[model samples]
Target: MEIKIKNLTKIYKNIKVLDNVSLEIHNGVFGLLGENGAGKTTLMEIISTLLPFDDGEIEVAGLNVKKEPLKVCEILGYLPQKFDFFPKVTLEESFDYLCKLKGMNNSESRKQEINLRLQEVGLLSEQKKYIQELSGGMKQRFGIAQALIGNPKIILIDEPTVGLDPHERISFRNLITRISRDKIILLSTHIVQDIASTCKNLMVLQKGKVNYFGSTIDLINKVRGKVWLYNILDDEIPHVDLFVSLQDKGSSIEIRYIADNPLQGSISTEPTLEDAYIYINRKELTV
Candidate 1:
């Protein structure tokens, strides 16, 4: 599915959560990187048609989100930053209830579908466990299972890996990557490594505005030659603004820095996506 947002704006009282944002998202895993209060959730809500925007036009899969919300919802699956489930309900029961809410009526077929989704998310073994009994990671997986019930073409996941441990996070990211082959999966997160390893394209938001958006390679290429590596004594570390620090086998310290001129013990260094993001944001902040 194709998602297009144009001149989108949202406000709560006098605070603007989204400031005339515009973006076009196509099939693949597109990462949304931003800090808290950067409007990531607000943008997701507006795109999912869960919240009305103060101004803007959003079209998903060729259907207008505001005017044709029902159609939009039919092909959309959204796992918000904070999801709630019935306290006393079991995982299986919760899926059943969500299916009903989505207008599914065939009990047997729904159960089979839910079971498949649970298995896909590695939660099938915990299907009979009560929602309250599940751990944070389990509950997040359950939320993902519920979001996949309708075979959505456009999936929006907000902070999907927030509470997951390193192992679970990798598993979840892999699952999302596999599922994104034919769908447009919008994953909003603050983890640069997540985007670096999983997403091919990304959008970086700063203060409710898009600071950068494009292919990951293009973004990383921006800082390609600006990064420098310096082999410095531990005592000299404080003199450089280290972008990355590593310990050498010989007790020397290797540091990546941003400098206009070559330092006393510096060499050219390759920049990573994180370096590009830091450079862009730092430049923006200074202006």
Candidate 2:
């Protein structure tokens, strides 16, 4: 299955939020990577039929999103970045409401489907828990569970792990990886770890434009020979164009940075997804 987008554009108050964005997303987990206000959320909203675009065509599984919005919604599941449920509602109650919204009129079918989705997301035992009772990670899992109610062919997830702790984020990433088969799961996030760990293919957006769109490994390779590891205690690192990441070693602060030339004491290091992303942003690297 594929979601085909061509020359997709969205404008808000005469400003182009998405400037002719185009993507051909296939089954499995695909990543939408960019910083805040990079138009990532706008693209997700357009694909999920939650917002309108000014120009271009989008076909979700060969169905035109504009021409057949309702049909597309039937096969599309959306977990928005700011997803929330009624705080007073129980998990079961939330599922019941979602099922009804999706037109699952049969009570027995809704019950069975809700149980299956809950079990798939590893929340079956907590179905009786109130919405307000779930932790951040649990809330995201429940969001996915609700998105799965209609057996959607395409699932658009926006910033799923924004406020989660380290452990919770990793757990949620594993869950995304586990269920990302036989369908298109488009993940939008600024966390490079999420893309490095979960996405096979990703598109990097920069200021409402496509900067890079290809395999994750290829993206990492973009910063090869530019990444360096320097020890601050021993010798000062050069003024680099991009500061990829830094770590504290108590006595010495080790910095992994990207630059055209390495310092005298610094050694060349392997590139990571984050390094590549920083390099792109620092230099405006285009595809």
Residue 22 in model 2: shift from native, Å?
1.3
lDDT digits (tens) for residues 120-205 of candidate 2: 99999999999999988889999998888888888889999999999989998998888888889999999999998999999999
Worst 10 residues of 2 by lDDT: 278-287
Full-model lDDT for every candidate: 0.84, 0.89
Model 1 C-alpha lDDT per residue in residues 178-244, reported as the tens digit of each score? 8888999999998888888889999999888889989999999988877788786664554554355
Clashing pairs in 1: none
Write down the RMSD of all candidates, one decimal each: 2.7, 2.8
Misplaced by over 4 Å in model 2 are 234-237, 283-287
| Candidate 2 overall lDDT versus native | 0.89
**Clash number for every model?**
0, 0
